[model samples]
Target: SVTGNRVAHTANIDRIAARGATFHRHFTPNQICSPSRATMATGLYPRHHGLWRNGVALDGRLPNLWQALSLAGYATKGVGKLHFQPLLAPVERDMPESLAYWERPGCEDWHGPYFGFDAVDLVMGEANEATRAGHYAAWLKRNHPEVVDLYEPDANPDSRAQDLNEVWKSAVPPELHYTS
Candidate 1:
């Protein structure tokens, strides 16, 4: 495909390709987001990991790359998006609505064996680019209040939880955008 790609000519991928062989195909066990993440993290097929759908996620019960490394005495830290749990569901009926893995208030306090990560700055809400409000949100709150409203516009402390808007674009500055 790079044969016809104008931008590809400017990319250093050419150097990499010259040093190696180029192939167009790749493999994955599943197409769903959390399941695919779990597969890579846990090194298990979707069925084996017991997270075959979007609303479910792997918990402490599973063995993952982080856990293996941590067990061997590595000091682990995860920043940015790490979807170790399901965003749509509660952890347990008795437990309070599950704490987010991303930049949740107390999330930074818990030094866990969480999905093998000793510490995490998690970002959930992969459903919509506009929906993420985790550590990144906290960062904005601390460093730049003006940009905070753009990402979590309805996250008014005065208001109770509002339903998130689905599949939409935010006109927030590109400098403030996660993709940028």
Candidate 2:
């Protein structure tokens, strides 16, 4: 369906056809985030990496790309989301429902020196409008008490609805726009 979509005909994607090869047949060993990312890290499929879902962490024994790169004398720096486990104490599995407004936990520990990255800018939570205002948990308490009181598992009245490109454009700072 994505191949048939008109948006795929746009200039940016069209350039892929003009000078690049597109893999029509590719597969991820796991459909979920952590498992998929682990597969990427180790160049092994999910069965071998053993990361199953959002919360399950990769065993530290498994060799990862960062470790290999570091061994090769590369200065690793990660700037965006990597979805790896946090370095702090294993995160508490449970928090108030209000806290559920935040991003899923785990992988906060996966950044920085632990992962052989010399520098990292990590956000352990959702990077949306509500999160930009402050902690989504605290924002819920002060601003949208009614939404919080509803306790509906997916009631995000304050979350900003944004298109993918718009969200991406807004994320880039003016200073960096010229780099494109």
lDDT of each: 0.59, 0.50
Q: List RMSD in Å for every model shown.
A: 7.9, 9.2
Give TM per candidate. 0.63, 0.52
Candidate 2, superposed: residue stretches over 4 Å from native: 1-19, 86-111, 125-180
Cand. 1 Cα-lDDT: 0.59
Candidate 1 scores a C-alpha RMSD against the true structure in Å of 7.9
lDDT of 2 by residue, 1-180 (tens): 225663222445566566887778897688877678788888887777777766665776788898889889998876544555522323263221122323355423333464556666443334332222113334354665544433331233432454343322233232322122
Candidate 1 per-residue lDDT over residues 1-180, each given as its tens digit: 244563223235666677898777987798977789889988999889988877675765888888888899999987656665655554342111134334344653444445777876655454234244565555656677777566653543432333334323444565765544
Candidate whose lDDT is highest = 1
Model 2 TM: 0.52
